[model samples]
Target: MLEPILVAARGRIIAGVLGGAAGVVVIVLLVLALTPRAGGGTVLVPDETPAPRWAPPADPPVAAVTPGPYGIAGLAEPAWVARTAKATGIPRRALAAYAGAAMTKASAMPACGLSWTTLAGIGRVESDHGRHGGSTIGADGTATPPIFGPALDGDGVARIPDSDQGAIDGDTKADRAVGPMQLIPQTWRNWHTDANADGREDPQNIDDAVMASANYLCRASTGLDTEAGWRRAITSYNDATTYIDAVARAAEGYRTAADR
Candidate 1:
């Protein structure tokens, strides 16, 4: 009987040990199910899209002004002149002269579409609005220190002998292009006008130069409104393909910048 009792006690101890082992296995499985896997676990991600980059607002279009005189007693400048000058990096006085010349031309010759930007283009190409070579445009529209082109003595340039006799170009031997617009003495004499209404036709004066340019451009067969007209007018100014291209590029730049 004692042997049987010992055997029964051994069986009960073995069963208790097996039950504890089974309980540990179940607890391990529960822990594994509650815990997250390395990369297979579900995560709460916010569904949102990123904002786009910002851009500056577009500028409003400038209104056109009625045609009028561009002299000292000329019409007042529209508010857009200042704004366009600031936008295009051009000086206010130069911009005003260009705009004033265009308006004056419009009044004098209504058929011509002489925009201020075109004049500005020519000014930039010619003498940088009279600021070329350390020179500046004075308050009276005169280029300070004066501006003169190389003497046209047939030395790889047009061979035009002195026409003014040292009166205008100050060169008694050969004629040199004078002023910011680079006008030959004869050409200045032919198309000269008192743009400033100061009773004198001065080539060094911005107003005089601008008015002369407008007159010459308008005299072209086409009126500067169409592409052909524009090209023809610009050619009339310099008569060179390179010059026309440069003026066109500058004018387009000014126009596009003003719109911005």
Candidate 2:
């Protein structure tokens, strides 16, 4: 009777243990079923926020200007004169010499009566004082020099001939402007002369080109002889409003620089 009772008690303990294990298993299953897993959504984190803009520094350094009479007798401030001389790449000393020569020549043609300021302005507008390197249009197509500058297509991309004969061969499509003043081939042919005494007439030469422009404007037909005539001549020289205005402004500037 005692042995049977002990065996029955051991079976009951085993059943309790099994029941507890089943409860634990069920709890674990419930947790797994209710708890969610990670999904395929993106979590974006920005690296940095933008900063507000600030004002620029005040009292910027001014450029050094050379002192001289730019093209006029002596009106330009030293700094302004220096800048113009440097811009033209014409040495201050050489520019002075040229100014002297120009004054002498200008004196003889008082009837032409244009101010140095105006002449300087014309130079500024015409070719920006030989800064522009131009190309020729030819029969094959538009021919550009390897080093033509940004002003080439001021209004539009000018088509030129690729062949050497384009300009000479009567291809209206092939002829493009040339020289410091951006003179058309026909115009250049008319005005080109040895202004610099270099034996040959070359429009690319700044001194020659500038002198030629002066001559063309001061010529009898252009009527630069009178103030009104000079105005008309300038208008014909450049048809743009801004260009005309700039020439006037530049001429004043040049005159101021030259006088000093």
Which candidate leads in TM-score? Answer: 1
Per-residue lDDT of model 2, residues 1-260, tens digit only: 00001111111100011122122110000000111124411111221433112111111112224423222223224454356577544334323323432453455565555444455444443333332233322221122231121221222333333233434223344433444444444445555555545465655544444555555556522334455666665654543333444455445444444444
Q: Candidate 2: which stretches are off by over 4 Å?
A: 1-108, 133-173, 220-227
- Predictions: Cα RMSD each: 38.1, 37.6
Candidate number of the best lDDT? 1
Q: Worst ten-residue run, lDDT, model 2? A: 25-34
What's the C-alpha lDDT at position 239 in model 1?
A: 46
Tell me model 1's lDDT, rounded to 2 decimals.
Answer: 0.59
